[model samples]
Target: MDIKFSGVTKIFEPDIIALEDIYLQVDKGEFVYLVGETGSGKTTLMRCITREVVPTRGQISVGGNLLRKINRFDLALFRRDIGVVFQSFLLLPNLTAFENVAFVLEVMGLPPKEISERVSEVLKLVGIWRRRNLYPPQLSGGEQQRLAIARAIVNGPSLLIADEPTGNLDTHTADEIMQLILGINAAGTTVLMATHNQYLVDTYRHRVVEIHRGRVVRDEEQGRYELNGGC
Candidate 1:
């Protein structure tokens, strides 16, 4: 999961520059935090890696795929190798937890038995196997978030992207969820997590990349949260 960003920039319009000439890298098996304030381009960087948005200039290579240069027709297969988790759970209100996990596998064209086995495995990995039959409406905030994590990793993606994953949870729940992410990282999924939690930023002390005003403001190993009264 080697990722390289070389002078990448994204401008939505004449005045709104989401990111500018960002150069960075994530070595294989490394865990990193992308930390910044609102609209600081953390999300933009993640989206660029995931191919959700196109870059205006420069280059980004994740694993072996040159995301910024890939053809539109080839994006889907590239996406399957990378997983993304968001602040919102994004669960289907009408679907059971089992169905939610199964849905991703189905789209990827796995066999029925394989999908069933994989769903059970990942839900348990996230500690939600018992709630597999429940709907999103029946779960707690943390539980819902865990379900989102389950869905993200069910396909066993080599690279994981989490954008403000704990934004919607309470403090204790946030801590637990962050722990879950770290545990996943420890198991060798190269992780790039975008967060605003200063407490979490201070606690983990992993590789940190800070963005400010659409630029890479700071990047450090085992970093602490600073600036704007954070940490």
Candidate 2:
């Protein structure tokens, strides 16, 4: 779970400079936030780490692979170290919640018996086992997001990365999602979240990496969200 980024930059053609010379690291089991206003390279940074898009320059090494250069052939092995949950929940609409989670294990070619057990465990951990038979449309926003979290973790990856995980939910639902994520971190999964929810920052007080423009402006241990009006 050693994630190290140094001098990383991503510039799309037509000159949209998303990130510039960014550097950061998160060791195993640390919960941290990448906070900023929209278009502040939060998603771009996540993409760079997960190798959805390559960095235009510099290096991003996670778990042992050089993300900038890993070929598609090697990607599956690389992804095995990390889990990602996006704001959209990204569940398969046709699959039941259990199957949505079970899909990951199936991809890894795990035995059905083990996959079933792990999926059950993760659903319970995310507080959605009772709803396992339900499809995406039948669940509430919070439940959908929880299912996303469950799906992300069912593989038991070393790092968990989430982006705007509760952006669409009501404050209470968002808080519940936050607590579930915090609980994941508490149970020894490293979480690196990209969020704009300042209240969650003040309330939970984890480490924070504040991204302004395209750079990491602050990396605070025991972080207190210093917004326009203080936290």
Candidate 3:
């Protein structure tokens, strides 16, 4: 769904400012790219949306739910509507591919049958079903990433937040993963992806929000990674 950040500011202890007066709005079903240097506020902004880091000041809302006001009891429910994919493929090494995705539904307390159906559906969707019996360490980087994406989207979240998801992959593998992410966005899932890959950013030609030093420097529609640049 839609995300709105109004005058949001976040400061860590000992006077470390992670975000400052950040005001942004992402419409539902839009795919937006977050581009910035390392240590920029992109990750912090994503974390704020997920309530992993509460805003030190101002307000943030996702689908009309005020983040700062959400209580512990409702936080889990709120997070169910969002999916996160990290740069490192954070798959369970011990669990098989199917079990890794199944674990998410299990924790949500879904019935065994329903979990089996949903897990199967997503594993196939990510093209990892044939490798369902494989453990994380047994899969290639691309295969592991596919499994990670499958696990993230198994719950059918409305919002997908990815942080450098293709960073650790080769060009061809990264392109494959990017296409899968684009397909998810095409299916009307709101996407916020943080990346340093200029080729993908420019080629995709989606909305670009550039952050620098904990502040938004630019926001553009159908924007390239850099001005006067194209893939």
**Best-fitting candidate, scored by lDDT:** 3
Best by TM-score: 3
**Each model's lDDT:** 0.88, 0.87, 0.91
| Model 2 poorest 10 in a row by lDDT | 222-231
lDDT by residue (138-205, candidate 2, tens digit) is: 99989999999888888888899999898888899889899988888888898999888888888989
The CA lDDT at 172 in model 2 is 92
Task: Give the runs in model 1 whose Cα sits over 4 Å from its true position.
Answer: 228-231
Question: Can you write out model 1's per-residue Cα lDDT over 53-73, one digit (the tens) per residue?
Answer: 888999999888888668876
- Checking candidate 3 for backbone clashes, the offending pairs are none
**Model 2's lDDT to the true fold?**
0.87
* Candidate 2: residue 48 lDDT (0-100): 84
